[model samples]
Target: MTECLDAIYQRRSVRKFTSDPVDRQIVEKLIQDAQMAPSAGNLQARDFIVVTNTAVKKKLKEAALDQKFLVQAPVIIVFCANTPRSSRIYSGRGELYSIQDASISAMVMTLAAHDMGLATCWVGAFNDADISEILMIPHNIRPVCMLALGYPADTPDTPDRIDASKLIHWQSW
Candidate 1:
């Protein structure tokens, strides 16, 4: 399989991480690569908050349904969407597209980290108000997801996939 395909197949949502700290430089590079993702008309409405501070991580952990793994991981990246920027392009449909854009960016960042010998977990279950307060996200931006990153304590095998036959169709649904 091609390297990119291999990475996609191998990437898993790692919930356990070692105490080792991920390099700041590498994290920056991954974030940069994530921005290369296609956005709605290249508006690049997605914004990221990189949390490396312990206190902030702790607060985020509380906001994130008491997910201690978030605090244990060396890095936590919060992906947010700038609705106003996206709204300018697509009008009524901008909100949906902007959400899609942000989610794709977060997924890419997680896969990139896996390819770089790191582990990450994408988190979406949380209170928006608490998250915004904890992360200081602006009202105009909507939080899409948060990623917890570090070296893996354990890597689980790939989860089962649905039968392709059940998902694929010829021309119409």
Candidate 2:
């Protein structure tokens, strides 16, 4: 398989991490890859906050349903969406679209990190209000998700996936 496809297949959510830190330049490049993801109407409403502080990571871990791995990871990226930027044109649909934009960007970042031999877990269980208060997120920006990134302390086997034939439909379901 080609390198990109190989990376896609190999990508997995890693939960345990060592204390080693990732290079700042690599993290920035991953963020840049995320920015390249397509956005609705090209509004590009996604914003990211890279968190490395111990206290903040601890608070974030609490916000994220006490997921201990969140604190263990060397970096946590909080992905937020600027609702007004898309809502101006798409109205009610914009709110949802902006969320989609942020999610797409997060996925791109995850894939890029995996390609670089780093590990990540997409975390979505956080209390939005709590995270907003802890991170000081702006009222206009909604926190969509968080990604915990670092080098893995353990490698996990890929979980079983449903057969493609069971999921695919021809022209109609």
Candidate 3:
């Protein structure tokens, strides 16, 4: 299998991580990869906040339902959707697609981190109001997702997948 495909298959939501620190350059590269994710009509309305400080991570941990992994990871990426930025591009359509675009970007970031030998766990289980307040994000910016990244301390075996035949059909059902 191609390395890219291999990476895709091997990528897992790693929860435990080593104490190793990921350099800023690697984090930047992952964000660059995320920016390449496809968006509706090419209207990239996503904004990302990279948090590397321990104190900030601690606050985010609380905001993230006290997930210790949030602070344990070397870096945490906060993905937000800017309604104004998206709305200006596609008007009504942009507003509808902004959250979707942000989600796609977050997925890309996680995959890129995995490919770079770093592990990541996508954190959507949190209180939005607390997150917004802790992150100091304006109300105009909506938090969509957060990613915790670090060197993996463990990688679980790939989870089972549903049968493709059962999921796909040649034509309309």
Per-residue lDDT of 144 in model 1: 89
- Location of the lowest summed lDDT over 10 successive residues in candidate 3: 87-96
User: Candidate 2: misplaced stretches above 4 Å?
Assistant: none
The list of candidate 1 runs beyond 4 A from truth reads: none
| Cα lDDT of model 3 by residue, 73-145, tens digit | 9999999987778888678777668898899999888778888789999999999999999899999889999
Off by over 4 Å in 3: none
Residue 80 miss distance in model 2 (angstroms): 0.8
**Best of the candidates, TM-score:** 2
lDDT of each residue in 53-140, candidate 1, tens digit only: 9999999999889998998999999999888889998986788878878888998897888888998899998889999988778887
What shift in Å separates residue 51 of candidate 3 from its native position after superposition?
0.7
- Candidate 2, residues 1-173: lDDT per residue as tens digits? 99889888999999999899988898899999999999999899889999999999999999999999999999999999989889999999889999999999999998999988899999999899999999999898899999999998889999999999999999999
TM-score of each: 0.94, 0.95, 0.92
**What is the C-alpha local distance difference test score of candidate 2?**
0.94
Candidate 3's TM-score: 0.92
lDDT of each: 0.89, 0.94, 0.89
